[model samples]
Target: DNIRLSIFVPIRDGLCNWKLQMVCKTDNIPDKERTAVFELNEGVLGYTFLKTRKHQIEFIDVSNNNNLPSTYVSLNSDNSNLINRDIKGVLVVSAFQNGSVAGLLAIDTENVSDLSKMEDNKLHSDALDWIIARSKAVKWIWRIKNNV
Candidate 1:
């Protein structure tokens, strides 16, 4: 089992202020078939996460977190129902560097207990640091390719 790390950058397209353009993901998918992009609407999880620009965790229990927009509650795919049966929720974290948000990292877990236990563990910190570093690298690559 592998965790998927998605890198999103804010792009403007007329009225869309904070449109999250998916630059890359750690998942092994064909380039021509990847379409995991979304807009960071106000009060949604992506907006909230991007605003904080800090490492945080979210237990995405759609049944309980109705306040979260449908788009914010799921990450497995554009379709929320595609969530894995064993995935009780997801633990998402973000990275920021050079005074700007870089990207988001998410991991699927079997239950809340698994994620809760990771809060203060060394493994969690190490993994988070690695993910942040990778995200920064991906952002750099994206900027170079797009001449941003």
Candidate 2:
């Protein structure tokens, strides 16, 4: 069985602070089919494939409401008849508020017989890159504004 990984990045501001959200997902199907398995609650949302052999998918949302984090939700289950019996999909929903994001990540694990091969370092590195890029871009914008 093989799975795919994906990462989503979102940028927004609320009140006086900037917020960034990154969602990661893993699955063994196409994005269109994968999307039909999960739902998002607020802000902006999107998905993409990141890798194979343990698919990962991500949903990201950004907002200004400090209390929005409590409203985040996720639901996941396996559909054996949809595809190969060994292929499974996972859904993750995350919310951010007051410069923070919180949410749930769920996986359809009926088909997965083992969890000993999962590696998440790449995902962390990708997230780090996203934050660094955003920081640099924001700083550049501020520099330009101060000069003007």
Candidate 3:
């Protein structure tokens, strides 16, 4: 799929920090702050993607779900370090695989009437699907490399 996955490296804080240098190469679909870096502290988007370690799509409010990691919540609150530079109506999805996050697919839009609106969007869906598919491909490549 030739997905342009942004590679993040873990920092001394034990948090996976986004590499600023790589952000420029990203597509930034739907348009957003060019200088913004993802903040995963008490934010739910970070909690879901980084803590739960699964695929997730989150809207503006970061604390709607009770399953969000307590640690993530305490560290990054809904009002603290907002995603996409505190944009009001942001739709974000994280694609993590093989126990590590490869990249995030996001879009800046008005209040979406339905979550499906984000998922059904061709640009958004393709980015997410491509990330997942690419992650799987990485696993297979690694397995073959190790002859496992």
Candidate 4:
């Protein structure tokens, strides 16, 4: 299993737009970092909610800064980046109900090479597909739990 952590971000209607509240993180994440509140169209979380995209998630590993795209990267300051350096692969998908997005589901890994397993056509890993499939369940849980 290449997955080190999986997180569910519930999208709620804010004053102007939607808000991406990060929660339901696996044990690996520090409790302090797990309660972050992110806005729509902020870093990787933003890309998943783009209007032009479909209900699919792709595995992306950009541990190397050189390979990371400028669009996906977020800066808190001129020199600070939000994404952790230890993170490797990441995939995100939006969960929907009645054609409205309800939540976001994401999976990530610390092993950079493990993410490339499916890439190399060497190992059979459904981790990416699994996250996409489980997205529906994520939405179901969020709706019931948060009464959204």
Decoy 2 TM-score against native? 0.27
lDDT for 84 in candidate 1 is: 38
What does the lDDT read for residue 146 in candidate 4? 61
Q: What value does the lDDT take at residue 37 in candidate 1?
A: 47
Tens digits of lDDT, candidate 2, 71-133: 444223432233234333333332222342322233332233323222245543454454344
Q: Write the per-residue lDDT of candidate 1 for residues 20-134, one digit (tens) a residue.
A: 5556655543353234445564223464464554665443543245545455534434423332345544555666666665555555445555555434456457657776767
Clash count per candidate:
0, 20, 4, 0
* Candidate 1 overall lDDT versus native: 0.52
Cα distance off (Å), candidate 3, residue 46 = 2.5
lDDT of 3 by residue, 1-148 (tens): 1122232222222344332111323463222333333355434345445543466555443223453334644423433343333233335556555655544544444333443444456756665676577665544433443344
Ranking by lDDT: 4, 1, 3, 2
Model 2: runs farther than 4 Å from truth?
9-28, 34-98, 102-114, 119-148
Range of the 10 consecutive residues with the lowest summed lDDT in candidate 4: 75-84
List candidate 1 stretches off by more than 4 Å.
Answer: 14-16, 26-33, 42-50, 54-63, 66-87, 110-113, 116-123, 142-146
lDDT of 4 by residue, 8-113 (tens): 5555564445566666777666565554556565555655665425454544565765765556645344212334557676666666666656666666777866
Report lDDT (Cα) of residue 79, candidate 1.
Answer: 26
Top lDDT hit: 4
Total backbone collisions, model 4: 0
TM-score of each: 0.58, 0.27, 0.43, 0.68
